[model samples]
Target: MPFINLKTLLRRESVGGALLVVAALVALIWANSPWAGGYEAFRSFTVILPVHAWAADGLLAIFFFVVGNELKQEFVRGELRHPRRAVLPIVASVCGAVVPALIFAVITFGHGDAAGGWGIPMATDIAFAVSVLAVVGRGLPPALRTFLLTLAIVDDLVAIMVIAVFYSAGLAWAPLLGAVAGLALFGWLQQGPMRRGPLRQGPLTRGPLRRGPLRRGPLRGLPQRQLPMKIVLVPLAVLVWTLMHESGIHATIAGVALGLLMRTSTLPGETISPSDRAEHLIRPWTTAVILPIFALTSAGVTVTGAGNLLASPAAIGILAGLIVGKIVGIFGGAWCTTRFTRAELHPDLTWPDIFGIAQLAGIGFTVSLLIAELSYPNDLGLLESAKAAVLLASGIAATLATVTLTLRAARHRRRAPDPAG
Candidate 1:
């Protein structure tokens, strides 16, 4: 491969999954080291909110923004454009979430306080899951990634709803109304006079900048363009995010709302839609910088009370939910949906592929840690223990998925038509 292509593959591909693990490992080591006090102090230090809070709310919101964009694109022109294809992920995502919550609740039963953390394992960290697939799944059907993406997106939506409804400290109506109005405006602006397909929008459709020879002016040589972001876009986005935060709505929803509302059709004179362009521009940054930073801050759990963490109902619930509940829920839901409904697995895939993907879903890291932070704000010991368990479960899930997917890919490779023919 050329240098640029190789560089891009590293930055944009499954290598990020490995990077996430490295960052978390660094944090875990630091937190449990002789300098553990430094980690705690840094974690607790605040500007407006503590370091962990900013990571969970602010950094993770950026991550979800990309997810929202993916969700909209899939709905617009990808696998989700058809009802038959969409049903599998939608059902499986729900079952995947519900089963984990049920398991967590059952495990934590008789302890009402610990049971509140039931929401922790109900999420799948798509970044980790997709990246893991990309890394170890060389000869696997491409459709498997699509299936994983669709399932993860649906479950992400479910997770967002859970945070908004079940986890919010208290709902404040006025700011929420303002947030709704702001989001509406954003959608309207992006969808401006657009139709089924690409149409004219910018300078090309208007004034002197329309097809012509170079005009004589100081700015004549420059390509004519709009700068709405500098003028209104960024401020409007900040205002919406602030309103959502003020409304006690788990501010990440603002990212999802804006992302879902993005117009996915290209405008005339553009090669790609605005959403794709934004994702292309932002995804690498989020994957490389934002996710690792969030991991560093949130995964820094001291292991002084290892025995206590093992015994804690909250921690045990998280472990059981991700390790067991996710696989059973996701795979079972998928199997039933395919068996009973008209929908079927892609021709390129098989049950083993689905099983591997289901196992990947068990790697709940980013959103899981965020929910853990939300679920036990008052109980520091419980919070750390839960976070520790999330790290542990995610690590184990990643290992299991690697073994399964690697074997599946090897089998597929062995069965391939010989290029020597």
Candidate 2:
């Protein structure tokens, strides 16, 4: 099947990401304008659902769904399928998350309640990071893009674990039970005879199945057949949201778990036709619609007193951590691992080239912003300061990465031998 090429879609994400930056700027300007109050009101305006349950749950659940889809894809077909192939990126990502959290914890150590915000810098915004790589246009290799993406996915997984473990407030046994039941039901549906028909014949044939022509069955394309996966999963996801709201765990944790469950992939290294109908359906929805909306909603922030940002501790912590942490964690970790393990760097890339890509990894705007909001919703003043820091750090990192890589590319071009010679 001819599926939409991910490389092409990723290129489009670069363009969309530029638009998001512009939109964010417009939102900031409008929020601080004379009509600033109106901007706040608009953002705060509630979109009520028939089910009182969902309105209280907020948009974080949707965010988790997208996260789940991405995670599933990576595990199924992308970077994480082969443990050996995935090891270096995973190590770098873990270090990237851990060092920043440790830094934040140390800074906010004495303040018990405030220290909960330590998870704020743990996520990497793949869109912004990829966009920077696109601009850099040289020195960076395609493998670098894959490596960054893999690391970002790993970073997200760690962030989810942190949110689930540390950020949860109280435990409500009943609702938690309901969530478990939903997951079990969803699991049964996935493993049942319904999914076996096409999937058995489909390209993925590594675990307990063989490649062969699909068998026709009553389970073909029944939404009811697929119902348990989405139906129980989504509502239980809502239940998790409600439980978290009551339990004091961040509501977003529920979203991430549900997202992890939703993503799927084909078997390893199989050249499945891109034209597979399911892939066509899921890919566009995820890339274009779900991801962009999440970025738009999450990235808006009003930076009223920019000067305060320079002096704010939260601002300083976030900026320093992302700009310093990402580059150090990624290149440093990769370099150390390759040295010890003797793993080959992607053929076209050098240490300096990888360093430039590492700089791009500092583009943590979207995820950083979301985590900040979850970490500190009541403190708008602090939030604004943190947002400013994230923006500035990401911008500087992206600029450095882009300029250095482009120059390196130009130098390489100048030295290339002429075919006519």
Best by TM-score: 1
- Ten contiguous residues with the weakest lDDT in model 1: 192-201
State the lDDT of candidate 2 residue by residue for 203-273, as single tens digits: 34444334333346664442221222344445655665666555544455565565555535232222342
Candidate 2 ranges beyond 4 A from true positions? 1-11, 49-80, 104-117, 131-140, 171-188, 195-278, 286-288, 342-349, 370-383, 404-421
Clashes of each: 0, 14
Candidate 2 structure, TM-score to reference: 0.69
| TM value for model 1 | 0.84
User: How close is every model to the real structure, measured as TM-score?
Assistant: 0.84, 0.69
RMSD of each predicted structure: 5.3, 7.6
Q: Model 2 Cα displacement at 335 (Å)?
A: 1.9
Could you tell me how far off, in angstroms, the CA of residue 198 lies in candidate 1 after the best superposition?
20
* Tens digit per residue, CA lDDT, model 1, 193-230: 32222224555546643432224455443444433332
